[model samples]
Target: MLSLLPQRILRLLEFIGFSGNRRFGLSQLREGASNHSLRSILCAFTLLFYNTYVSLILGTGEGNLAEAEALLEPYQEKYPKGSIILFYSARITSLRGNLEKARARYEECISSQQEWKQIHHLCYWELMWNHSFQQEWQQAYRYADLLCRESRWSKAIYVYQKAAILSMMSAEELERTGEDLGALFRQVEGLKQRLAGKSIPMEKFAVRKSRRYKASNPVPLVIPALEMMYVWNGFSIVGKRADLTESLLVTIEKVEQQLQNDPNPTEYHPDDSCLVQMLKGLCLKYLGRFLQAELCFSEVLSSEGRIRYDHYLVPFTLYELGLLQKQQGDFIKATTYIERAKTNYKDYSMESRLHFRIHAALNSLKGSPVSTP
Candidate 1:
């Protein structure tokens, strides 16, 4: 959790108290996981969760997949149809960019048990993202709709996600669903709730985004689902496949052309275009078109001052540029750019999420080996 703190706060903590050591913590967990105790499974689970999900989402995308597999091997053998093991197996596969296999595994997990609707909720979430990573908006929307109706995890997030996925569909496709997109977005704010006296960051982000639809004649969000995809580090998962990355680029470019051709652009036009350019940069970077990716990122940075609502774009783009630099094996420049992003920005949408990624990136640059997309 110390990794989540700002640098200045971390420094203050060090002066007042000795911070917990990650390596030591991991060592203890490993010891507990190896022992034949009641909580051994819990220890193993903590490790598996960190290695499989947390590392990829909060840190760099270099999750220890092999280690996660090793940890789950025993559990899988003992309970071949265990929902949790099957779910982790699916997640590991998804992280490796095997969307089809992951989808099958998630379905298997869901079918393995009926006593736990919460487990089904977890699988639904993965299924939603798996379909999303494949750009199957209808199938994705199906899962999101299920989550909205069935899961009580966070209605605000689920409803907003449902609306965002619908935003990706064509008018006829959306019409067939008979759901009002604006109404769904309007539900987001009221459904939002505080957890443990603090608002959830992603929920708040979703609520703020949904606020746009509150105005009369609201300007439609451009690729809001894809934007949330980036927020959740979904691009890193999709980047594992050249075909997927290239397909995403094609979608972004088409949208870019449409935005460019608009005669009377709204005030949010620059922000929307910059959002597209950032997504394009990520796709290009994953496709090994580093020069083109850099140009896309630079374009976003150059237009930083003009971005109206998405102030987060500038710092996040800097973070992306840092990752691109690291991919090119330029550690010095990578650290410089990432540091600037971490220190120079605050109070933006998803700031906490970006800080987690920034922390992960710096750690990877310092010692951890990062896999290139």
Candidate 2:
């Protein structure tokens, strides 16, 4: 909760039009209100709500579930129909492992708004997570499909990964019931094939990949953590796309310096190196250095056995190459690269990525050489 004094300070600053500074601050006022005025009361209410929303978002990001929930509870009371508040509250609940309460809140959010399709998809995702926790394979698969239909790529990837695990569990259950294991294996293989050739957008994949790596590797945490902090400061200085390019260059330089100073170069993980190269490639692409980006991406793709697990790096690189080719009006090469990405997505359960590749392929086929940035 925001203190009354802080609220008064903010009001005074607003009154004096002292909103130039981006950093959060409190300024002493000349006089404090002895009696409540309508304007003062409204200002206080606005400040309270603004503080609560910011606290809830930051709390969730920091994994502070208790604080997030406490901040959201009052908003839920004051504005019962606010679906955004309910969604955040439910997210916090889900994070805290209270699936039943989370489900109730999500359901309420869905019921509160019919126009917001994203909320509906979110509710289904929550349900899918709950079902997965209980090892209910069939129910989980159904909800997963629903989520995929809604273009919830990250959550959809999670669902398909769970489905693969569940398939193995189901195989054991079926064996006890005298069912054929070979047939089950064949079915699983077929599903994998279907999901193989797709790719997710590079930007979205980078964000997810960074978070995943952050859990295990401390190196990649620096850039993303700094980016998060930049956002926290209201994106005041680094809000522009141009700022992102500068930041990316800085990060690439830092990574390069680290690599140069390392004694055992071969001992360094290929994934980490590939990630750095990929970031450089993305920055080049953003700066309209198409050929350079192409070379960087190509080098990463050609490097053998760099990634141990299923990663979207290859497909993402291929997709970007296609975009570059399209920009250069090389429709033939663009089509080939995008088609390759699509094939990879089909093999990798990256349906969302495949969707973008398909659009690119379609444009190429139609002889439309100009591509959207």
Maximum-TM-score candidate:
1
lDDT of 1 by residue, 134-169 (tens): 889999999999999999999999999999999999
lDDT winner: 1
Error of 1 at 186 (Å): 1.5
Residue-wise C-alpha lDDT for candidate 2, range 1-373, written one tens digit per residue: 2222222354687688754231132121101111245454343333333343333232212233454455456667888778877877776665555657877888888899899887788677667655544345566556655764564445424433333323434355634545332332223222222235543443233334333323333332223322222222212112224445556466566875776577765423566566566666766766777778788888778863666433555675676577668667877777788777766555443445344335424433564644433
Candidate 2 weakest lDDT stretch, 10 residues? 26-35
| TM-score between candidate 1 and the true structure | 0.95
Worst 10 residues of 1 by lDDT: 364-373
Q: Taking the candidates one at a time, how many backbone clashes does each contain? A: 0, 19
Off by over 4 Å in 2: 1-240, 265-268, 344-352, 369-373
- In model 1, the Cα lDDT at residue 190 comes to 96
